[model samples]
Target: MKKNVLRLFVVGLIWLASCSPLTRVLKNPDINEKYQFALEFYENEDYYRAGLVFEDLLPNMAGKAEAENVQFYYSYCQYYQNQFDLAAYYFKQFYDTYRRSDFAEEALYMHAYSNYKATPDYNLDQSNTTKAIETMQDFMNRFPKSSYFEKAGSIINELRGLLEKKAYSIAKQYHRLRRYQAAVIACDNFQKDFPDSELKEEVSFIKMEAQYEYAKASIYTMKIERYEETMEYYYYLVDRYPNSEYMKMAESYFKNTQRELYDLNP
Candidate 1:
């Protein structure tokens, strides 16, 4: 019980020690003194405190020489705190306002990078992912020789991979749900969007299967045309992926489609 009481007292003392300086800096009326303390906090990697001080100083420092550094450091504080959306906004604001500053290029790059960091999972909405790619591409275009160019390219490719995965999963999900027509359309869109995807072979096979199923379920008047479409898909699949793992199933689909078409015509 005594040790516990002593520990609690020590913890309280440590908290007060940490908070005391920040409290003093916060209450100080002198702008230059507060700005200096803010930089000290930032240099010490106490970004939370530094951000608080910077936020307070920002409005008062407008049009002053210190405004630029304050804004730049403020953005960094947000980024270091993992506040990516806010970081992206502030970084972009910094670049737009200080295009001629030496840090402008870095600010723009961080703006793109922050968006990249903000991208959601493959299963989630990818509007932010697309925006990240565009911003990174813009960064590369503006700074061709930038040290960050390779990193930006790599990020773009990674985000594209996520998009490809999402698109493929959606197409495959449609097939699994027995939504054949939607599956066929989604498969076609996926192939068109990611012609170089490693999943192209699987997507083609799914398209063939979907077409076959769709034709089988169609009305008498539409059966012949739909089966004919299935046959066309099957031929395309076999022609492109002659040795595919899905070849056996694909050929079965083809034969079924051919038989159906023959019965309809006869």
Candidate 2:
């Protein structure tokens, strides 16, 4: 009975505290006391309320010593709530406003990283992906010795891979659809754009296959020249990828093409 009474008493006191002046702080207009309350809410991990409180405090706290802390935590409050757009905006704003602050480096990293989080799949629009790479690279250039340098480089590589995947898929799709001319153009463009891609060997095979198909489909007057072009690409593929997975398929093209060329003269 005594324990139950004690629990009831504690609960009532908590309800009164929350319902009274403490709850009214959010509604209060006094700027100084409000800033203190915002800090208190942040310390307690009430990020939603903290964010609202910080928003209110920002206009009042600007040009004051408390402004830096308010701005810093405001960004974090948005971040903790997974509001990445706002987090990115505020984080960049923080660094821009307080470049000498201790939080500057972290703010910049999070700004770029926040956008990275919002980036969609490779097939989607990649403006955010582009932003991430550019911002991370800028961060690296500006802070070459920064501890985040390695992490930034890793992110840039990951974004680049996403771009490569998109380009590879588009070219491969053209090849698959038997649009040989477009396939040749797309594969060539993909190679130029992503010269370092691991898909280079596969792309080489695609170009060879596309050229062979184009020659076979060409008018009689163009067949000989086109076939010769296909053979040239075949030699290049063979020299570069002797043990390639697509070698068997390429060999089939070579045999067929050779028979046609011989029959053309015969």
Task: State model 1's lDDT.
Answer: 0.95
Q: Model 1 — which ten-residue stretch has the worst lDDT? A: 15-24
How far out, in Å, is residue 54 in model 2? 1.4
Query: What overall lDDT goes with each candidate model?
Result: 0.95, 0.89
lDDT tens readout by residue for model 1, 1-266: 99999999999998898689888898899999999999999999999999999999999997899999999999999999999999999999999999999999999999999999999999999999999999999999999999999999999999999999999999999999999999999999999999999999999999999999999999999999899898899889889989999999998888888888888889
TM-score of 1: 0.91
The runs of at least 3 residues in candidate 1 whose Cα sits more than 4 Å from the true structure, single-residue gaps closed, are 1-19
TM-score of each: 0.91, 0.80
Clashes of 2: 0
Q: Model 1 Cα displacement at 128 (Å)?
A: 1.2
The CA-based lDDT of model 2 is what? 0.89
Best by TM-score: 1
The alpha-carbon deviation from the true structure for residue 77 of candidate 1, after best TM-score superposition, in angstroms, is 0.9
